[model samples]
Target: MSRLLSKLSGGQPVASAPVSVDAHSLDPQRSAEMLAGFEAADIGWFWESDAAGRLTYLTDSAIAAIGAERDALIGSELTQFLATGDSDDLDSTSRPLKFRLASRSPISRLNVTVQTSQSKEIWWEISATPRRDANGEFAGFHGTARDITKSLAQSRDSERAAQFDSLTGLANRLRMARKLDQTLTAFKKSKRSCAIMLLDLDRFKKVNDTLGHPAGDELLKQVATRIKKLLGDHGEIGRLGGDEFQILLPDMDDRGDLGDLSKRLVQMLSQPYSVEGSRAIIGCSIGIAVAPYDGIESSELVKAADLALYAAKDAGRGTYRFYSSELSQNADWRQRIEDDLRDALTQQQFLIQYQPIVDAKTHKIASLEALLRWEHPERGRVSPADFIPVAEELGIINKIGEWVLEEVCTQLSKCPPEVRAAVNVSPIQFASEDFYDTVDAILNKTGVDPARVELEITESVFVGDLERTLKLFKKLKKRGVRLSLDDFGTGYSSLSYLRDAPFDKIKIDQSFVRGCSADDNNNSALVSAIVSMARALKMETVAEGIETKDELAMVKGHGATHLQGYLFSGPISIDELLDRFDSKELEFKPRGPEKYRAERRTEFRKIGVIHGDSRYNVFLRNLSKTGARIEGLLDVPVGTDLVLDLGDGQLAVATVRRSEGFSQGVEFETKLISDGDRGLCTRHRVSPYQIEAAGRPLGALTNSAVAAYTTGSQSVPRAFVEVDMNAYNRR
Candidate 1:
């Protein structure tokens, strides 16, 4: 082989001959031809631009791919033919392609989109080096470009898959978290507000269990669609997971607007859904938290919204709640209640109270409605509203409900056979597969006639499996038990169900009864319509919550067959009821407040009253929309203006209207609004912006934190002098 190489080397000096190649292959023209062939094959293309960013040259194949002639593309501005890529990595420090070109900087593997008249877009990965003349004067950019459209699309699909939920096609938890973080960071700099609402579909688990998971999945999709339709471009909605959703609304801080939106969302979500020929009804609970108010960080804001959501659910599903600092404490209390509820039954913490159902025409006691009450040993008479839901959540509601049923049956046996007793049933207990058998066993054990026991069921029982609900009603009716629909108009109010369900009586919801006396209220018309319908169906109508004479007269005029409420009697113990029956007090004379007034919650909370640099510790005895009654300030004269610092940033400027002894009735300058849980709160609260301006963190402000905006102001003229109640007492 060495002798042959020496012969091929021309036989002159083969000792140090360099590696040999074909002479034709070494020609510069042939090399250039090979490079041109590579370009024509679409492996890559060459591009050049002048110092003015005008395209000087482009490969013929590249121009052909864009459906343009080389001559036409040559003089076009580069930016006119290509745009900067929308890459996530483009940060604050990144420069645009035009700026890079102007600065004569080298760019490597920069992804760009080619502008074209074609319907389809083309993506190019480009690498370029800025060229200069001998004098180092900026000349142009010389670059190689490659088509990366297919790879870019694959990348984008992967990114979308990672960010969006597969089931509902909404943003998943990871994406939502990142979006919240980014939004909060950006909004912090602009000092703009953002609201985050976290919602969970109520009874969704029941839907999943009753129907298959596929139906639940379909329901979730419909929920997402409805939310998008209602929100449109107002916000971004995401399904965090399995019936839980999060909404991001930017630049919205108004509590009134938030409250309305929350209510609308709940209502919209509560509408019945048709899933695969099966009807599914579910409600939603919303918890809303605003940026720089509830929290400034993403995690903190999400937690606040979650706590608010829990409060909404605890208040009874199908409602919304705005986050207050107290919600966290309430959440802890709820957890404690849930723990305590597990043992409530065995500990005998529950008792039954009966409220009389009177005949509207005769004003005579017709029957009694049994209500469940829980008296926590430590908490002292815990409201059923506060603990029944906890029992339900802890899966002990059925047990408690069974106890109530048995106890009510025993009490009904004690009452005269003519006086019947109505027992309230929870949807959970009513929907049990063995509910019919349970009722039969209880009746057999107590030896009470079924006709003397009316089973009162709320509208919620009609939510899932209507056929089954109708069958349950049939079974109960077959046992000769009277069936009554309780809180009739407060829920779905489906006329279709009312048409088929065998309801012996229809009870008007207290909400309607509460406002029936108002001349302008639509509740009167609703009650009239309900009564007319019930009469047509041969069913009796019972007006609930008739607390005033006017309300009683209105329902009676509207043709209500029976009346039940405080006007007749409060809930009494079974012993007290027996005693009343023994005393022959079956005829109830209506005795209640003369007029229907705003609901005033009775509470005992110590709060601060600021009057001209003096902060007095006073006990708030009762609070209402227009005024509050406070004690501990003796001899506070009328017309004295004071700032009431209800904790959690609620500041009310009130003037004492009535002063007697140590108690004062003060009217609010601005009426309070519903706090979403049967409580009253100021219409407006201390703004986080003010807190920030006061050099404190943006959140629910402490009294000291908000004092700068409220009592800290010294410019206001004093209306009255501060009186030391303690000093007067000492004297």
Candidate 2:
């Protein structure tokens, strides 16, 4: 009896226990009364259910704790009052409370939620034993339940800490990885596509250097908030540590839509951020890779996306790139260039050429725009588009800018007083503290007239501190140098900046000028508005990239003050300019295409054309976004359906729209998009997995190769006669 009392009291000693108790004191009825009293006093409560799992009995205290009357809970279903908790050890073999009661099995410490009348859910740990009749038939269950809300809350907190970023309440690296694995596994079965985007803040390092770490943290939080607001229910986003973030978009493979979304992300992230009462500005670069096209698994997809991101950063830090098979090769080439660029400055491999910007009305030179050229010993002349970005990435653009400034000043000293020279400046160079001093020293050393030197700065310069930028402009103005806003309407052009900052000229971006003459194009109206606005602001306007006679005439009619493009002259050497100046021949005749045409890239390569069951060899003449021209087929009917095998698994469905003597103009059903290297590519390509399933290696296949493998047993059913290329060439 004493032992029983001690066990009921949870191993606590019973005070003044009789050594020899009367028979009634140790009776079963007495024991039941003591157990009931102990349960009412302790944190646990008792419950019972009938064989049908309906509540048969419950302690009055337990009923009151749940804010329910005895009558209300007596016949209620037991499972309706409780739900299973997220216990780590629960698995397939661990039966639920209802299943255990039905199977007449003992349940030990199973966690579940108890629903209450007050609409509150409380977690409880429960243990139950089955009750049976004298015939050994299952009857009901008797259980003890203790509230575990506090401990469960702590456990949940720990789990959240492990899975989420502490700084931004977004999923951390571990959670993102697991979720990506699960999503990919499921998507593979459904044959649906997924896309992953990897992005990193472009100028975040500058923010951390200028402000403190705490401020940087606040900036990241704001970035996450902005992303959430933009994405909403579209996708899942996670921070992959530091300034890097990852996004998982399910069932999205359209590059056009992806490109638009990426552009929006870049624009949103580039906006000004207010952190702790200080304004900060930054940008982000995105790299995208779609599943089954770029990769098949999480790791592969992540690596591909990272490579794309690297390419975007390499392309000048304010763009996005989609993954391609050739990106790995390009990445390697980019690394080599970055390594070689550091020594190119000392090797005397860089030179300057001047392109003449002429007056639109007089057709004479207004100012010579200085351009930088890099001559690689092995690779010949490297495009400025390629090397300038490398220089920016290497943090040597400022040094290169200073060199150009000094050289321009020296060149200006030799030119006529009316022939001013404009030098381009990068945002990195313009932000330097010593930029004004460097300009002053150059003018002083070269003894060039300040009026003959103009500084050309892009709109990106406005992304930094506006006050300091204005101060720098004032300092340069005090030195009598000219300031011209370059690529004026390309980016976020604000009228407020133009009104506040002193400038002498505004150069319309080439994009606006290229198609200004088209009847359907809005660029003509845009250019007219810009020119009129510039006139009102008392600023000179220069229309750039005037490659056609129509474009030149249109801009001139729009009241542009200056024009610069190939129609006047390509970039000329200093000696060539001096010769032209010495001969007193500044006026140049306009020479270029009369009207603008869609730029088609010329190509000479063999491809395959599949019509019906026959595949024929054809020569691809030229390619464009909308259509392609093919040769080696005679008298193919117009409106004939054919598939052009553009190698590398790019199969484009085209229709022969124009047929003439072995040359046909085929218009693609789906328009091709930019391949990020000034080349056009199909929006979707055949997956390598599909090729592997066809008993071929898992990689890109040539057009002829795929044709031979696909139509092995079938005989060719030629609908049109194939022209003999050798005979045709001889004729």
Of the candidates shown, which would achieve the greatest TM-score relative to the real structure? 1
Our tally of clashes for model 2 stands at 0
| Residue-wise C-alpha lDDT for candidate 1, range 615-714, written one tens digit per residue | 6677788999899998877778899998899876788999999998788999999888776778777756677777788777765455567655555556
- How much is 471 displaced in model 2, in angstroms? 1.2
Worst 10 residues of 2 by lDDT: 11-20
TM-score of each: 0.91, 0.87
User: What ranges in model 2 sit over 4 Å off?
Assistant: 1-38, 85-104, 117-120, 519-521, 599-621, 630-640, 657-664, 675-679, 688-731
The TM-score obtained by model 2 is: 0.87
Candidate 1 RMSD computed on C-alpha atoms after optimal superposition onto the true structure: 6.5
In candidate 2, residue 341 scores what lDDT?
A: 87
Instruction: Give lDDT: candidate 1, residue 629.
Output: 95
